[model samples]
Target: MRRFAAAFAAMLATCPGLVHAAQPCLTAAEASSLTAYALPSAITGTAKRCVPNLGTNAFLPTGGAELAARYAVRKHQNWPAAKAAFLKMGAKDESSAFLANMPDPSLQQMLDALIEGMVAQQIPLDRCAEIDRVVGLLAPLPAQNTAELLAVMFGLAGKTGKAKNDLFSICES
Candidate 1:
C-alpha cells in the first residue's frame, strides 16, 4: 500500500495538467464563451490583410488550447508576469501590425482572460487592478502585415481553425 501511494504521488507531481484539471484555469462559462465566440470584426480585418503572409507557419500544428496550457504553466499562474512575457514575445508594435488595428473590445477580452487565469491560478489579487492598468498602457500592435500575426495569436489561444477559417473567408470577400 505504501509503495502504491508513493508511485501515485510521483505521477501527480510529474503531470501538472492533471493537477490543473481539478482546478480549471477557465470557468465553464469562460471556456464556453471562448469556444463559441465569433471572430471579431477588428481581427477579421487584420486576418484579411495578414493571411497572404502566412507562409509556412500556418501549416505548423500548434493549437491555441495547448499554447494556453503551456502559458498557464510557464508563468506559474502569475498574471503580470504572463502579460510581460506575452508582450516580450513580440505582441508589441515592434512585431505585430494587428495590434494597431484591434478593437478595444477584443483587447479587453484578452486582458480579462489574463486576469481571470491569474485568479484561477490563485495568484494574490491585491495588485491585479494596478497590473491591468499598467499592461493596458504598455500594450502595442503592429502597423502592417497583421493577418499572419493575428492568426498566430489565435492559434496560441487555442482557436486555430477559427483563425484560419476567418482569414480564408476574408480572402474570399
Candidate 2:
C-alpha cells in the first residue's frame, strides 16, 4: 500500500500541470473552425455580409494574411484599389475606411484576443496562404507592427496615445 501511494504521488507530480494548460499557438485547423464566426464583420455590424476592407495596409492579422503575394498586386494599387480586389472575391462591402492608419481600444483588445488565440492554437487565419502572406509582411515591419496594429484596434495608440515608436513593444512579455 505504501508503494502504491508513493507511485500515485509520483504520477501526480509527473502530471503535465499548468504547462499543458497553456494553449498552443495559432494554426491552420483552428483558424478554419472560427473563420466563419470570428471575423471582424461578424463582430461589427457595419461590415455585414462584407469582408472588412482593411484598406491597403489593414490586413496581416485582422483579415488573416495572404497579402504578401498580393503585395505586387497591392503595389500597383491603393485603398480604393484594394477594396476593388476584395469585391472580386465576392466580398461586397467594408467596415470602415483605412483603419490602416487609425486605431481603437475596445476593438484592439478583441483583435488581440483573436490573434493570441490564433498563435496559441497554431491556427491559420481566414485562409492558409493568407496567414503565410501576413507573417511575411509583419516579419519585416520593425517587430512592433503587430503591437501597433493591436493598439490601433484598441484605440490606444492612435491620435490619443502619443507613443508612436513605442507602440510596437505593446508591453508584450
Candidate 3:
C-alpha cells in the first residue's frame, strides 16, 4: 500500500530532473531484480521501526525476520541487475556520471541505507498492524515472486500515471 507507494514516491522525488526523462525505463525483470535486492533492507527497517508499536509478538518481530532473511539470501544474486537499474534511474541527468563512477561496494551500501531509511520513515505507527498483516500474508511467497509481484504492482502504478516522472519509469511489457 500506501506506505510502499510513499516510499517509491520519496525515492523518485529525491532525484531532481528525473521524472519524464527521455532515458529508457526499466524492464519488469530489471525492476524485480532491483526490488529483490532492496526488499530485505526494507523489511528489516520496517520491522525495526514498527516493533515498538507492534510488540515483540507481532508478525514484524517474528515472521518478518524470517521473511527478510529469505529475501536477503537472494540479494547478492539480484545485485547486478539491481545495480544497473539503480544507475539508470538518472541516466539522462548530470548525476548519471557520478553514479556511473561510484565503486560498486559504495553504491550498494548507499542504496541499501537509502531504501531502509525511506521505508522506515514512510510507515506510520497507526499502519503497523495493517503492514504486519500484509507481511504475514505475503510470507508464503518465495522471494523472487514477491519481488516480481511488487514490480508488477509498480508497473501498473506507472501505467496509471502515478509512478512515472521526470526521473523514473517502468518500461511497458
Best by lDDT: 3
- The candidate maximizing TM-score is 3
lDDT of 1 at 71: 28
Locate the minimum summed-lDDT window of 10 residues in model 2: 41-50
lDDT of 1 by residue, 73-102 (tens): 323223333233222233234324453345
Residue pairs of candidate 1 with colliding backbone atoms: 50-147, 64-157, 64-158, 65-158, 96-142, 97-142, 97-143, 99-141
List candidate 3 stretches off by more than 4 Å.
15-24, 161-168
User: Ranking under lDDT, best-scoring first?
Assistant: 3, 1, 2
Q: Which of the predicted structures, 2 or 3, would earn the higher TM-score when compared with the native? A: 3
Q: After best superposition, candidate 2 residue 1: deviation in angstroms?
A: 54
Q: Report lDDT (Cα) of residue 131, candidate 1.
A: 30
TM-score of each: 0.19, 0.21, 0.85
lDDT of 2 at 106: 42
Which portions of model 2 show Cα errors greater than 4 Å?
Answer: 1-126, 154-173
Q: Against the unseen true structure, what C-alpha lDDT does each candidate score? A: 0.29, 0.29, 0.77
Write model 3 residue lDDT over 71-110, tens digit each, in one string.
9998889999988887766546667677668898887887
